[model samples]
Target chain A: MPHRPALTPLVESLPATVPFVGPEAQERSRGRPFRARIGANENGFGPSPRVAAAIAEAAPESWKYCDPENHDLRAALAAQLGVGMENIVVDGGIDILLGVTVRQYVEPGAAVVTSLGAYPTFNYHVAGFGGRLVTVPYDGGDRESLDGLVDAVKREGAPLVYLSNPDNPMGTWWEADDVVRFIDALPETTMLVLDEAYGETAPASALPPLDVTRPNVLRMRTFSKAYALAGLRCGYAIGERETIRAFEKVRNHFGMSRLAQVAALAALHDQAHLADIVTRVAACRDRIAGIAAENGLVALPSATNFVAIDCGGDGDFALKAMEALVADGIFVRKPMAPGLDRCIRVSVGPEAEIALFAEALPPALAAARGG
Target chain B: MPHRPALTPLVESLPATVPFVGPEAQERSRGRPFRARIGANENGFGPSPRVAAAIAEAAPESWKYCDPENHDLRAALAAQLGVGMENIVVDGGIDILLGVTVRQYVEPGAAVVTSLGAYPTFNYHVAGFGGRLVTVPYDGGDRESLDGLVDAVKREGAPLVYLSNPDNPMGTWWEADDVVRFIDALPETTMLVLDEAYGETAPASALPPLDVTRPNVLRMRTFSKAYALAGLRCGYAIGERETIRAFEKVRNHFGMSRLAQVAALAALHDQAHLADIVTRVAACRDRIAGIAAENGLVALPSATNFVAIDCGGDGDFALKAMEALVADGIFVRKPMAPGLDRCIRVSVGPEAEIALFAEALPPALAAARGG
Candidate 1:
């Protein structure tokens, strides 16, 4: 009813939406907190004690802006990954890095490729930049189809392609050899965004060796998953020097939180804590799979910190099951693509939360079946 | 050279440059830390102890992703600002918000306007978005030329104009009445980004009351300045509901750090701490002015955490003086525009750092004077 400023045509064409509804928003709407917060693929095991200490120590110095170059964090990551400092660029998180990557490689109306129902945040970034998405459906195994993605990239001549190894929602992955084959198959001019956000949770064999000399590939890693620092929003892209340098052209130079730098640095230094979390995560995944079996569902084998439990029903049924779980004070997400929509995703967490999910699943399943 | 993936035309056209060379990069290059960290306009007084405690308390919870909606912090800010939740959008910092604002409003090759040497981050965003920047020289008093900005907007038919009250670099401000006049004179179609980053440090009469009714105006504020949480990277924009809603279309939805939310909430709740810091900032400004006077330089009246001291010399002379200070282990920065370039900006800080600058100033000036 009032005069409003005009948004750019590209932005005007986009819809205002959050790619995922956070548990907090659902809790606000429900007027009560969920009993089990095993959703969103966040590591519920929490960050290392050293990271907490670093954050505490860094908190008092909040009056100083973070290093725009992100020098120390980048240096630490470089040493840990056996890459040069020039090969890495630290950002607020993998989500922000995906956005910048889209801006760097995808022009308006240019075709971008991704597996259908892989990661919505990457799709969000692609659409935000006006890149026309060409999605390839996942293979029958619910893994991101490496062959299908390569075919789409070659067919559409897509300039940008996104592949999240040990993928979100389905918790499925391709082996490192297959990934290398896919990379070699892609046109050299087409950039591949190899999202390894869950790399720490996956088996080492699932990850291709770090190769910063490849100009067309950028591997993304985050503190959010296995490092258990999702709240800090720190991640990095490892790539060729020129590819890494391109982020400086458009990134918010002072965008990083100083505590994120401190916390991530501490986390990287604490490999024992990470190994401990990985062991816990593996045990929790087993617990989640056992819970799935008790409810007469099959939990997909996972290389991620979450399991996708096949609901043995249609999308509508899966949606109802997810709703029933939410109503039962449990937070779980489901894939919405045609083939993958029959599964509900539950993130690995501490035993207490896992027990809550175990307690809630049977009734939730019954409600979906009956109602 | 190795083959590289092609960047988009827009990205390829942009250059790789940071808006500011952070002190950390300087330290790395210089092979030592500066004796005084007074550049970048950061608050040297540091954040409240309560904020530190909140960050420490929130540290372990970094396993949970921040509420993408930023519900709690936004609600707290809404209550404090007397606005509805829909009228606010929280961002990483003013720097990130500026980038989003530029993306939402400025189409490629479209004219956008600001003072010649205001915040370089805003200009960086404009360039990143491929917007044509129409620059207006600062008026005689070193304040942003309100009339000059309006005329350029009208002449260029620019869609966006930026004005920082209690502005950066020169540390000059326009009174509320004049600001209101400038707002009223702007074309209804032209969106105004009213940056009030220094509002908490300014005289009460200098800030117009928060009004979320204007769809064409967005008032930006941050915890970075007077709140003493620059490193945490939390800032918010207040505008009409529709204007603010547009930000959701392009923002990195999960970009806000959870600890930043925790720290900002604590900072907002502790108004007494803010008042204490404001008082200390005022005293430090006076101390800086006294130091400038002692050195026969005139300090501009400042409503900010920084003072702009006129070196009473040309731009080249001021550059030499700033370089001399840098070589002397001080990190003070100077405005680089033709007219405003005669002044070097020094942030108000703890007495020791300020004293370091004071100790370095005489010799730096003498070196610039060819003694």
Candidate 2:
């Protein structure tokens, strides 16, 4: 190949990879849409009617650029969260926030700690910023090993650490007090990104109170899960006043679409709709667990919108089962990392989707077992 | 004061600032909306009716995430531009692309080059990434000094350079051949970001053909300009496949909202609407120039939706004039950097809005002069 313009030495050395692909790509590849849209943990229950109405109403007004300050939404969020306006900074989602936080802290070659198979998007940003990853294996309970992460952070002297509570894939969570202890133990020099993207569906016991007094922790929450606003892409971070203000340094000023702000603001005000979705998600998880028990398998306890069920075999068996489900037009995903790979991840959805999963799992497992 | 968490050295060292206070925020502070909203260079004509209809249709589907690959839009763009899909990367807008490009090339402490009073957002990104900025003053002429920029890049061994053709703030453009020479003259180790955001409005002779085969030059285009989709925030970069593919290493996979994709695709197909808007914009630009002449001021020739009128005084006089116009409920802005500060920027709008500007300028000028 002829010589070409080079990426910065750091970017050039990085791998060419993506953390995840949306289910739309999979459907396109399949040349057909799935019968059950319960994959990727998107709110198949959908956003509230009010949210959709707000979107439609605001569609024409989109000719004007979104206010870069995001004043109205931020003020609304402050009022709702009982925090001051300066305590919050909103963006497209926590994904963008993670990228920003990494830039704010990790210099190239700086150490950063995360779980072994935690949120891959976070890892992507860490590597993109040339931060070295110091990943700890999940605790045997399939929860992020907070103590191990703290140890690694101190050992590596990492400037940034990431954890997703009520975790994804496995859906296990650390309790509030354990989380508080973990926060207290961390060095002030290391910033903790507590991504509670699934916070809405999680039990109150799993969530610590949002206190802006702590400068070391940035709490990230999203409307993508229970609010059914995944397509809207609105998320925000809460931190001490100065830390929250720091996001303004590098955020794309006009990045958020005007309609997204409207959709998110409307969603926040519809607590009844959120409560309904959370109840539906919880019931769906229980129904999925019961279905797993009927099949003589085990479903992991979950605090999120998904359930991970063990196939009572190996990763290979789970892989075949997942593939069989896809072939049966029941879209679902499985963890590819070693220990986590024994389970197939199924998202909690409406009865129609959960029923489809129940109908397909038996035949899919038979195919996986070649019975 | 309590010691809350500290920002990273780079972030703390940066100022708490925004490039511009949004017009909406200004209106809120002033307790009323602007009568003629022609300040932010937005297309007052708005998006195509078809695009608005498409957004309305897609609003309900906001429950699902947009395709992370942006496959359909990329395929259509590739077919339109005679480039392969592998040669294109789409993002929120040119501002986001500039920031990502800066991150891809400039390491902390490395030099990057741009015109002193050019796009402040690009400079914001450079600082966000800790790249030391090396600014070249515009030549005595209003246009950016291309020769001076090239000289500075070579002298500083800067890894990245930015040049907005039909440049923002001034609205001047260079012909395709001159731009081609600029690309060819850059070092193989350096990257050039050619922002052709206003390409739809500029004369065809001014734009180089899309050249995705060039590894170092990435031409950024947007739907925000003549396409009239600013609020949607869709933009793309065209470059060699090798360079373009690297964006996969570090982008918010699910960041592009579903509405943005459908709206852009619809706008792209409605070329007649775009052409109509361009004609309307040109006519308005000429009218604006005439209005400026009537007021005994000079209107810099504009190939953009906005024109800068030389106030024939210092920066303070121009600023005072802009403030007075705002007081008259006509939203307008002025360039703030030293050499460019003597001009007030006004966006082209409908006839009524133009008349509003015509009626407001002389009185505002008189008031400003008296003050």
Candidate 3:
């Protein structure tokens, strides 16, 4: 073999695979754009007019680097959450936050626990850091199984656990009381990463209130969902002061973009616009469920901006249906793990795009059945 | 002790220090904003007007996630750099890239080498990843000691080394032939991270040609400097195909901001604007040098967007002068490492900001000397 620099043994063992194939990649391969971009759970309704205005206003200031401390945005988030400024650490996105969190807590060969099919990006980070992932299956109702996770954490004495409220792919969630019970059950040595990316669209009862006193839990939120700023790449982790401070040890201090801070602060200030987006997202989710019923498939109950429709077949059948939708210029996704793989996941978008998904579903279902 | 989640021993051992304190933090502590913001090496001349328009035009698209592949930008970069598309990987910034590179090549207790005080962020990453950093001091002429780096890499059997041309702090550079000789002298097993972030602002003869066939070299450049898009957080690394492919194993695939992509693409397409900014930057460097001479201080020859003005005294005196400048509402910084600490670094900015620095210099010097 030719001489070259050697990658660490752990990095060498990892595969070069992306957690999610972006819609643009599909569009490129298909040689055409998706008529309805409802995949990836992106908010097609867009950000507030105020945020657009903020971007335009801040465009000329692109020469200056961002405030490395992220003081102003973190202060806004703190005031809104009724938490101390020390409780939050902001970064580029939840994905980057997850990676940094893994680096902070997971040692090489340490066992990390999560649901089998939940948030591949977190799993990617765990593997990137050489952590051994122990996955528990979802419960009968398609929610991430709190009991199973607690059992695995105890069984393996795992140091890190990941749970997404109003979970991705399945769009199922546990109520606050049950979630609190789960948190209380975990050993103090185990850290729980509670991802609330979809919290704004979920029921009020579904989210636990901010509890920054706990040293073992970190709740992550983002502007990517109901705030309608997915492309801006801003997210924050709320935890105990010490836990938050640990992030400063490893985070790229200057990584946050200046416009992200500007746009997020503007987004937070425009609560009315966020309220408006939540309303539209709820209506669109209902519309998607209605389309599923009209096509004779059952849509799972969703507390998120996306709904999963049972395809009344198997994982392969669901994949076929998703591929058919893609071929029809409608972008939709599906859960790939066993037991949850019998459904197609569709995100909430504007009425026109949802209408396109509505028009195409029956035919796509037929094509899947034919295959 | 109260029970809590445990950070890895390595993280526990790391200090919670920022590589550089942002000017905003200083302003907040000082209770006033600086009259001139020339400390951080930002291009106050601003990005191309086309980039501003592009940002405004793409604001609504912030609802969509950035294409994780970063395909369009990579293709454009590939074309411009005269390399194949596979040779490039784009990310948020070079800081994030440095962190990822260390994660890939440096294992716990493994040796990494760089010039002392060259770039503290790179050093921060080395420590963050548990690598043992071996420093080579700059040569007597104030350029990074290439001969010293080669000897250290050979002696330590280091897996990674960093070199920045038109270096920060001292703003000193080596000609292309000298850099090429340094590259040729390194062992193939040693990876050299050639940071050419100042490439656009330097003389054409200062940058070596792109060589994608060299597996041991990864050259990084950014839109942050002469392109005047520091706030956008767009940077790319060019390397041999397999070497570039390694980044995919650990990078946050969706971390690139959508507006950054739009603005950077627009900036790259506007070569005329880049030419205009380069001319402005060259003039500003000379203006800064002239101001230094007028104050009876010597300005080092520079090939960057910043110049180093020697205070003709000890490190403490130079630091006092910088502090006085800050107190006078002129933001400036000094190199803190021994031997490099006799000078203050000033970034090229708008003429108005430069004039503020010019006005503040003499009084600041007098205060330092009096003290």
Interface RMSD of 2: 1.8
In the range A204-247, model 1's lDDT, one tens digit per residue, is 99999998889999999999999998889899999999999999
lDDT of 2 by residue, B185-278 (tens): 8887789999889888998999988877678899999999898888888999999998998887667778898899999999989989999999
Q: Of the candidates shown, which would achieve the greatest TM-score relative to the real structure?
A: 3
Q: What TM-score, computed on C-alpha atoms, does each candidate reach?
A: 0.99, 0.97, 0.99
**Residue pairs in steric clash, candidate 1?**
none
- The most accurate candidate by lDDT is 3
Order the candidate numbers by DockQ, best to worst.
3, 1, 2
Query: TM-score of A-chain in each prediction?
Result: 0.98, 0.97, 0.99
What lDDT is reached at residue A303 by model 2?
95
lDDT of 2 by residue, A1-371 (tens): 43575677888887877788777788899999999987788878888989888887887777789998888999999998899999999999889999889988887789999988888889889888888999988898488999999999899988889989989778999999999999999888789999999988889999999989888899999988888888878899999987888888777778998889999999989999999999999999999999899899999999999999988898999999999999999989988777888999999878988999999999999999993
The model with the greater lDDT, 1 or 2, is 1
lDDT string, candidate 3, A1-371, tens digits: 54999999999999999999999999999999999999989998899999999999999999999999999999999999999999999999999999999998999899999998899999999999989999999998489999999999999999999999999989999999999999999999999999999999999999998999999999999999988888999999999999999999999999999999999999999999989988998888889889988888899999999999998898999999999999999998888899899999999999999988988988998999898
Best by DockQ: 3
Model 1 / residue B355 / CA error / Å: 1.5
Two-chain DockQ for each candidate model: 0.80, 0.65, 0.89
